[model samples]
Target: MIWKLSLTGMKTRLRDYMILFSGLAIAAAIFYMFESLATNKEFLEHSNTVSVVGIVFHLGTVLLGIITFVYILYANSFLMTLRQKTYAMLMMLGARTSKIAQMIFIETFVAGIAATVVGMVVGVGLTALVNRLLVNQMGIVVSHYTPFNTAALLVTLIFFIAVFLIASMINASSIVKKSILQLLNEQKTPTRFKRNPFLLFIETIIGLLSLAIGYYFLAEIVKFQIMGLAIALVTIILGSYLIFHSVVIFVISLLKKSNAVVFKKLNNFTLSQLSFRVRDFTQILSMVSILFALALGALTVGLGFRNQIMTFTNTAATYDIVLNNAQKIDQQKIDTLDPTLNVTYDQKYDDTTIYYIKEQFDQHPFEQKDQSVFLSGEVNDKTLKYDAAKMEQDEQAQKALQDLELPEQKEKQIKLISQADFDTLGLDESQLQVINVTDFTTILPQIKTLIEENEKNNPSLGGAEGQNSFSQKYYVYNLYNTFFSGFEFMGFFLGIAFLTMLASCLMFKILSSANSDAIRYEMLRKIGTRQSLLKRAIFKEIGILFLLPGILGSIHVLFGLQMFKNFLSQPYHNIWIPFTIFIVLYALYYFATIWIYTSIVLPKEKRN
Candidate 1:
């Protein structure tokens, strides 16, 4: 008889059970996808550029675990509420408390086991699909990647089982404590506003201060290092919570006091619902804000790094194939490039007497070495060294250098010409004109190779020592690859983390408060309040809830990105790409949340 009753209870509450199962399944799938990249030690070690990437993944797992744990607890609590009245009836019929407790535990465990089995199957399939997409997007073959990680599956199952067992015990204990009368009368009570102006003021001030400190640390990330990152993170999280707790109330109060907008149209009803709803959800609101900031930051930085790579590649090279010793085969290879290719050619030389009279004067006050070979086929290692003692002792080098003191040796005169001496160099008229410094820097690699070939063929012209002299004349382009790599990697991870947290927090909050909302909607229907009005209220309420976090978080990201301007060559370039992507994702989640919330909260109305 007890088993029959338990099975009937499960059948009756199938909708609620389905919600619980679906939520867990989605969470598991996302977790598995993250783990596929994070847990593969060899893949992460090889592909990841950030030194602390493994640590970041560990932290991500911990955060996701906490969110999932909380979600499960909340879902179980709702299930307990649904069973409370039935349990009371059983107790009245002389069923033992211990028997009821045992039955409840069995039900909870059954639900958990069922959910886990389905979730794991879904997770494994999703992991395989996501891995394939990521591989294609990145254009890299990742070996040793396992979509079906036995360890991840085991860990997820164990962790979820423990959570369910703990929740079951709590539910069982609650059943033991509650009287039959209280259980029969159990229904959601309307939440009341408990305003304390002084507390609100204090919270607002503290929150502002925390936010300020977080911004300061973010701005000076280089100096304060990891300590700053930790502090900023903690402070920002705290501040966001306090802001939701205090600032949201303060805004609602201000809206209520306004005569023009508060009492106008549906604003009064909408604002009332927002105030009451937000009052019960201060922590969730704060969490949503943090996630929004993280998501936007990640997408922005990731796209920025990609843009930088393209820019660097474009700026470094002008021609597809630039060769001084171009053979017939080499020319054919160049011709086989993309049909849209463009090419240009310059003269070839075997020996060149390039003069650096101005550089000698700049280096020495007296005329000792009047000329230096700026380019040669065979670069001599010795010419690269600067002999300060020998340069200082020459009186003629001193006299030549007295009036015009140069900033650096590289900026001084360095000359290069074709090895074919002026006549047989085979130079085109346009190529004969000396290239501008700006343009020359872009083609420096081609120029260096050309010089090397010429000196190789004509060894009499500065060969070994001259090679070193040529090396000293040129500057190596510093693109700062290290810095961009770090930003790109961190950005991608941060984006994913933020979106996951945001969706979970908002989804949980909506679902948790849904039971109360159902009654409110029912009351509205019984009265003159139209079904349409109730829906509009729901839509407006959700809109405000989602909009506030996104707007404020975007503002924070804008100011935060300003701090990176000094470091990035084109910090603001293509910034819109990330923003657009964020908006599209955010909007989809918002619409999905509204649909889910309505399905859970709205009564079945007749279609006109």
Candidate 2:
């Protein structure tokens, strides 16, 4: 009999179950993706920026895990609400509480396992898709990554199953303890704004200080590093809760005090409605806002890094393409590109350096360019002098060069020698193919391929000979861009996961209290409140609820993005693009929230 009841309940709330299932699956999939990169030292070993990337993915995993855990609690709480009244009815029908608790456990456990299986499948697919998109679509190569791992799968199942059991036990316990009368009255939440002003003031002060401290640490995150992040995390989260719970209530009360505004058309009703729910769901609102900031901020930083790639190339390379050991196929590919200025020459190199005579590059001097946020340089006729890559900066690098026992300075660089100097060296010349293009980005793919092939055929051109291939600036920049692309991918992927979970949390919270809202709306309607006014009121109330988080989140992100200024040349560049994306997403969710809320509250005669 319990089994039949559980099945019937599952069928009844299939839509809610679907949201929970998908949220769990995506969360697991994203976690799998991050762990694949973070734990795989062998894979991270390939990139120059491996350490930074590894830290990012590791932190990402922890963050996602925490948020997922919270979401599970909230989601399960919602599930319990769905069954509370039913459980009450069953108890009235002579069903034992313990037996009902067993039924609840089985129902939750079954649903969890089902979601886990489907989630694992989706996780695998997402992993493969993310890897492919990062490597292929971004014109980058992140080779030797495992998308589907047995350990990750096992971890996902054990973790989620444990979470489900705990939540189910809590849910069942909470229901069983409540008297039949309380269970029956679960939908009716009294709107009682009762609080001490002095206590509220003190809480707001503590909340502000906490937020201030968090921002301080985050601002100088480079100084504090991970420890700072931990501190900031604790403080900011606590502060956010207090701010929403205490600060927001005080501010809304001030608005309520204004008689002119309160007497305005439906303003009084909307604001009153908002205040009532705000007190009950303060933590939810705070968390929703924080998560929104994280989601929006992640995508913004990703787009910013992506945007910086093209800019990085603008200055990082003077000659768009540089090929050593010019093969016939390479020449054909370069010819297809139709470069604005192409130079094919020869140079001499031993173990430590590649050298070309000044006269060789004198005919068509390559443009020397420099770009930065504060300073910019124009293209000028400059002979090849410095190394294509940045000069080695540390004492250890110089010592390492000396230890290697290479030529004079032991600093591998492009050398400009006078003819007399070149004659003295007596080193054999290596064929060189170089090009200056008007537009490199358009044919970046062919250029990227050409550069990769050359690096593969001649490892000596890369560094101080015997080192990993670090080709010309253009190619290496693209490689760096690829690494950052992985960073971008991580951010974008995690953002989607957080957004999904947050939307689920907020929507469920709103809908779960819907039965209570129905009574209020019914009372209002009987008092001659038109459906249109009520709808506008509904829109106003929900809009404010949605907008509060958005505003708070915007504040978080505005300050949060400053942390990335060092990594990104212009962190705000094209920032509007991501904001637009976030707006669209938030708007869609907002309207959807209104629709769900309306359906539950209003009569069917005026749903449109």
Candidate 3:
């Protein structure tokens, strides 16, 4: 009997179940995609700048995991709400509470198992598609990495199943304890908004202060170290919550004070719905804002590094190939390439050197002094030394050349000059040769040959070296490929994770309080509200819900990028690329949310 009942419930609530299923599937797929990178120890090892790659992936995992957990819980709660009245009726019909609890458990477990199976399949397809895109963009053949990871699959399965079971148990217990009257009255009661003045005041002040502190710490990331990052994280989260809880309420209240405007043109209904929604959703709104900020920030940072790679490569040299410590065959190989290409040979010695200059009295007169300066204001006989030995031997003076690892007197003899001077020496610049523009389209095979030869001969200078050693030697590709690859991979994964969380949170809150909203919509329909107006109301409500978090998140990312200024050689370069990407993704989700919400809240219109 229970088996038939469960199947009927599943069929009847198929739409709601699909929402939960889709959310889980997206979460699983995104998680698998991320893990393919994070857990691939071999891939990370092969990367040139493996320094922060692990850290970035680790943080990405943590953020994604938190989002997944929150989304699953909310989704499971939606599932429970769909069955609440039925569960209540079962208890009222003399069915044992324990039996109903057992039924709820089986239903939830079944849903979880079904979602996981479907999600894993979707996840594999997404991973393949995204991985292919990245490989093509990067222009390097990455070994075919597996999309299906056992550990990741197990972890995702365990997490969702546990959450579903817990939610089902909570729902069952709540139903078991409630009086039949309360159970019947649940759908009719309206949830009231409670305002505590002192709490609001405290939260508002603290939130503003937290945001200020977070901004300060982020701006000075280099100076304060990891403590700054921690402080920024904590304060920003607190501030976001406070902003949603208090600042948003304050704004709405101010808007409500104008009686004429508040009630004008369906504004009253809009504001009332927004107020109720916001009051219940402050924390989730705060979290969503933070996630959006992080997703955008990751993309921005990746693009920034990519821009730096391009500019650094383009500006530093004028060649497709630069070989340092070359061999005899290497020269022949270079000569065989297109004759029009400019090949400049140069020698580079690995050494640590420094220099000190002696002052000439006539050229730099001692008496040309500015006595207004209290401390050593001018070049004077007493303060200025001409003796190189004296300058080098002085312990205080010698400290400046400590990086050179030479006797102070020996270090003083070295002077660095421009490449123009070295070229005049005419000795083959110790094995460093720059090959100027060969056709980019035709040069791939030749470049590949050069890379293989160089790796064979030197055994240390890996692959084809380009203009900037950093990009070619390190990133192993041109600027465009590197930047595009990183952006595509990171953006797609982060976008999926973020949108899933956003939709699930919005859906959860809307559906949880949906019984009340059903009445409100019904009342409006009876009172001659054009179905269109109610539809508009639904759109406006959901729009505000998505818009607030998005705006705040964009602001956070804009300022957050400032923190990277000190570290990146060209921080702001190509920033618009990521911003444009984010804008498109955000706009799509916004419209989609409105459509989804409308379908859930409003009934279908009648045909003429």
Candidate 4:
């Protein structure tokens, strides 16, 4: 009988169940998607620039798991609220408390099972689609990436099922603990607002101070590094919450104090409604604000990393191609490149110094834009110890020598010697060839092949020991591409997931109480309140709810990006792209929330 009644309740409140199921299912899907990426050993190994990629993704998994757990718990609260009246009536009619507990467990578990099945299927498709899109958009070739993995599937199944079971058990226990009278009176009670000026003032002060500290730490992040990041996150989160709790209410109270503004048509009602909603949903607003900042900040920083790649490669070396230990076959490949200018110099290195053949340099006369090589002038004893600090005094020399592609050139000195002196060293001779082509990007594959061959004989030319070695130009470029592309993928993935979950959270919170709010809207309608005015009031109320968090979140992002200044060449480069995407997504959700909230709470016209 209880099972039949629970099923009947579900049928009657299909809209509420739909919202609950969809929210849970979306949460589950995102969890699965994240796990799939995190657990994909092949993908991580292939695409990673650094070794810590696995650890980073694992940490992301834990954070996302915590977030999903909280979301499920919050969404389940609405389920409990929807069933309170039904449970109360059952108990009043002599239904056993144990049977009521069974009903709650059955209902929650059934919904969870259904959402989990659908979520996994959706997760698979989403992962594949997103990975493909990111690969294409970033022009990165990531091999060994598979969206469907048995480990990810198993982990998602186990994690979500456990979460759901725990939630159901908690819900059943809590429902049984409530008295019949309390359950009956819960929805009928209104959330009251009481002003405490002293507390509000204190909260406002604390919030402002916390935000100031967070901004300062972010600005000086290069100095403080990770510790600064931790402090900034805590202070900023606290400030956001306090601002929503006290500063929002204080502003609304001030707006109410103005007689002229209050007397404006429907303005008073709008403010009253807005004030009530703000006071009620302060914590949700704060959470939404933080989520917004994170979503936008991740996307902006990710794209910023992408923009820095080419800029870094260009400035790191002057020539399009720097071929060290150049061979005859290498010259053959270079001749195919149709270079505008080619400079070849014989090089010999010993324990502490490199020798550049002066006769070869004199014949070629390496020049760039009417600037000759800095080592061209005569030196005492025909030798010059390479001093990077002094070399910077001549920009052309700094740029020209950087193209030599010698390992640890900055730390080593260079000597210019005649043929007789060069033979006296008895060191092995290698040729350094610097070539420039009309287009650099079009010849990456050719250049990459040369780099690979060079690295085979000379492993030191790679990114391993000499991280800043110019010989590792190709390696470093690919390293940055893969590293930043991972960040980009993670950013978009989490941004969309968090935005969806947060939207559902706010939506479920508001719509679950629509039945109680409906009575008020109906009473206003019967009192001859125009439908258009009511619509306008709904617009104003929800708009303010959306606007407050959005403004604060954007401000947070504006300051938060300062932390990435050292990591990215231009942290603010092309920042408007992410902001535009964020605004569009946020606006869409804002309108959708207003539409749905209006449909639930407002009284429709009695048309024929």
Candidate 5:
């Protein structure tokens, strides 16, 4: 009988269930997405840059889990509200308390199961879509990536089922705390407007002080490493909550004192509604702002890291191509391509030419790179000179050989050959090709193919297929692009997931209490207030709510990106991309909220 009643309740409140379902499905889909990426061992192992992609993704899992934990609480509270009246009616008719507990448990479990099924389907679709966009828009090639994973699917199911079961148990335990009358009176309660000026002032001061200290610590990031991150997280999160809770209301109260603005038609009502909504909505506002900051900061910093490849490569070397043992066909191919910059070196090595640069070749002095190598953190004005090496079999000489960047060849040692020995021993001739083009990226494929073909025929060149023909810029670009591309993929999806949850939370906070506003709007209509005027009030209220969080969030992003200053050349680069995305989506959600709010308060004919 309880199961039937629970199913009936679900059928009656399908709209509320849809809201609950969508949030759950989106949350589950994102969880599965995170798990799939985090668990892919082959993908992380192949990344060229210095990072533990697994640890990073696992950190992402923890962050998303925290967000989901909060979301489930909100979801459960909404569910309780939806069932309050039903529970009240049941109790008045003498339904057992144990029976009521059973009903709530059944309802929560059923909803979780339904959401999981729909969510897995959505998760698979999102994975494919995200992969396609990364490849098409970001120019990344993902290998051994499977959108559908049995392990991820199983983990997602178990996690959400556990969450739902826990929420149900918590709700079931609370059944004894409320009386029949209290449950029935839940919907009738007027919204509370609580204020404490002294407390508010103190909180505002503390929030400001904490934020200042956080910014100070952030400025000197190298000093504080892990401790700095901890202080910053705690202080900023606390400050944001307090700022929204107390400071925002204090400012709003000041605006209400202005007769010029308050006396305008329906302006007073709008301000009053905003003031009431904000008093209790501070934590929600703060969470939204923090989520926005994180999403935008991730995207901006990710772009900066991705672009670092191009920046490092461009300034690292002069010539676009460096070929060893240039053959007749190689020069023919190099000439046909028409390099704007060319330098040829003709030298005779005393021994094998591949392992060393002849000391006698210094007479014809070839230029070495003026910039630092990719893995090295600094650049020097030092030029490559083989004569500088001690040439002895001592520790210092071996150290000098190991540190030589002139060869730039992976794992190759250089020993200088004497001119007298070069003349004494009859050695083979070798040629080097240093060629530069207007653009290296566009013509890289052709160059790579040409090198591979040459290596296929002449084995003595001893160059790897992809490693041959080094263009300083193109070389670094090829090396680091894959890593940054993966980072960008993670950033893009994490941002989307956060923004989606944040938007849904804001929307639900407004819509769940929409029925309560109907009486207020009807009373206004009876008192000769225009429908247009009432709608303007709704628009003003929701718009201000949406804008407030976003404005605050953008402020956080401005300073938050400072933490990444050391990791990136320009921490704030390409920031507008994420900002534009946030603004557009937030605006649409705002409008949608207004439409729903107005529809509930005012009928179609009245609104028209």
Candidate 6:
């Protein structure tokens, strides 16, 4: 009998159930996606150069787990609300409370498992699609990464099943504890907007002060680092909440007292409705705003790093390739790049020391003063000294001589010899060639081939030696790939997950209250209020709700981006790209929420 009732109730509210199902599925899918990356040890090892990649993935897993848990609870609570009145009716018809609780548990558990199953399937698809997009967009080569993984599947299944079980129990218990009368009267319960002048004053002052401090800390993040981030996170979140709580109420109150605004059209009704719902709306708005900031900030930072990959590479080393004792094949490969500039230095090496002619260096200078610029000065004839203090003080000269080491050679003293002395040495001579190409990225394939050949010929210069050697083009290539595939990869997916979850939170929260709001709309309809006017009221009200958060969130992003300035040359570079994308998505959600809310409350027009 309980099974029959549960099925009937589900069929009756299939649309609402679909919303619940999709929300839960999205939560599950995002969790599964995160797990896919976290569980892929081989992929992490291959793609990331960061030492703490495991720790980063662990933190991400915990964060996503917490977010998914909270989302499931909220979604389940909405499910409970949708069926509460129906349960009350059954109890009044002589059904036992225990029976109803059993029915609720069965429905919740069944729906959860169904969503989780669908989510895992969708997760695989999303993993493939997102991975492809990242690879193409960022030019990263990820190996040993599969869209479907048994470990990820198992972890996702275990985590979501446990969450669903806990949620089902909580939902069933909450329903059973409430009396039938309370359940029936739940929608009709009145909500009030409270305003205490002294408290409001204090909150307003503190909120503004908190925001100021948070902004200051975020802007100066380089100096304070983690401590600054902690303070900023706390203060900004608190400030957002308090500011919304107090300021929104104050503004609505002012509008309520103004005859010019309140007496206009349906403005009075709108303000009254806002006043009643402001307390709840404030919390949602604040949360949504913060989530928006985080989502957009993540995407912006990720794209910033991606766009500046070449710039960062150039910063580390000026020349595309610097080869000691260039071979014929190497010169041939270098020629294929249509060399913009080719500078070679003549050198001779004896038993205890390597010598470079001073005149050769002066004639065609190839020393780097900075990351990109070449040094402009005459070379002095002196023995090269490896003084740590002197090298640290003269970073430009240190960087210029960074590629002094050669394969299978003992550490030897380097000296600048006169042309006459260099010619008289009779030691074996070699040429160190520095090649520059018009575009570094255009010749990456050839560069890789050349590097592999070099490493093969000189087995002593493999792995760490090749990777850390600034003179090797392979270093730039590897660094570029690692940066995009590591932190940037994580950032992009995190943004997408947060954006989906938070938008659903706002949509579900609004829709959950639709039934409670239905009676008021019906009352307005009976009193000759046109459906058109009602929609306009909804547009105004919901539009305000969307607008407030968007404005605040954008402001947060503008300030929050300052924190990345130390890491990035220009953190705000290409920021509008993410902002534009977010605005379009957010606007779509805004309109979709209104349509869903309107469908629940308004009557359909009759045909002639």
The RMSD of every model to the true structure, in order and in angstroms, is: 10.6, 5.7, 9.1, 6.5, 4.7, 5.0
Please give the distance, in angstroms, between residue 130's alpha carbon in candidate 1 and its true position after superposition.
3.9
- State candidate 6's TM-score: 0.87
- Tens digits of per-residue lDDT for model 1 on 1-608? 76777778888878667767666666666565555545656545553342234454455556566767766765677678778888999999999999899878887888887877787788788767755654543333677677888877877788778888998898889887889988877544445566888999999999999988988888777678799878888988888888888888888888888989776756787787676645557766776787788678867966676555434433332222222223312334333332243322222222332222223323422212222321221111222222334444554443333211211221333232323443444433211111112343455555455545644643433432432221222211212233344345446645754665576567656666677777777766677776677778888888888887887688668756755654455667878888898888888778888887888778455212
Regarding TM-score, does 1 or 6 come out ahead?
6
Best by lDDT: 6
lDDT of each: 0.61, 0.73, 0.63, 0.73, 0.69, 0.74
lDDT of 6 by residue, 1-608 (tens): 88888888888877767877886787677667767756666655654453244454556667777767877787678778778999998889898878988888888887888888998999899877766764564444677578997887898889988988898889989998999889988756656787797788789899888988999999998788899989998999999999988888888888888999998878998887777756667878888888888877877887776765665666556567766566534466777889887877677887777777776666755445253222221122222433333443554564456454465443555577678988898788777677778987877778767766766655666544453365665575565655555557667766776777677778776787787677888888888887778889989988888888888888998999888766666677778888887888788889988988887777455100
Comparing 2 and 6 by TM-score, which wins? Answer: 6
- Please provide, for model 5 over 472-509, each residue's C-alpha lDDT reduced to its tens digit, 9 standing for 90 to 100: 34445655555566566666666766777777778777
Q: What RMSD does model 5 have?
A: 4.7
- Among these predictions, the greatest TM-score belongs to 6
Which structure is stronger by lDDT: 1 or 3?
3
Preferred candidate (TM-score higher): 1 or 4? 4
Q: Between the candidate structures 1 and 2, which one is better when assessed by TM-score?
A: 2
TM-score of each: 0.63, 0.80, 0.72, 0.81, 0.84, 0.87
Candidate 3 residue-wise lDDT, 34-55, digit = tens? 6655565545555444323445
| Candidate 3: clashing residue pairs, number | 3
Better of 3 and 6 by lDDT: 6
Q: In model 3, which residue pairs have backbone atoms overlapping below 3 Å?
A: 346-429, 347-429, 347-430
On the 0 to 100 scale, the lDDT of residue 112 in model 5 is 76
For lDDT, candidate 4 versus 6, the one ahead is: 6
Clashes of each: 20, 0, 3, 0, 0, 0
The residue pairs that clash in candidate 6, if any, are none
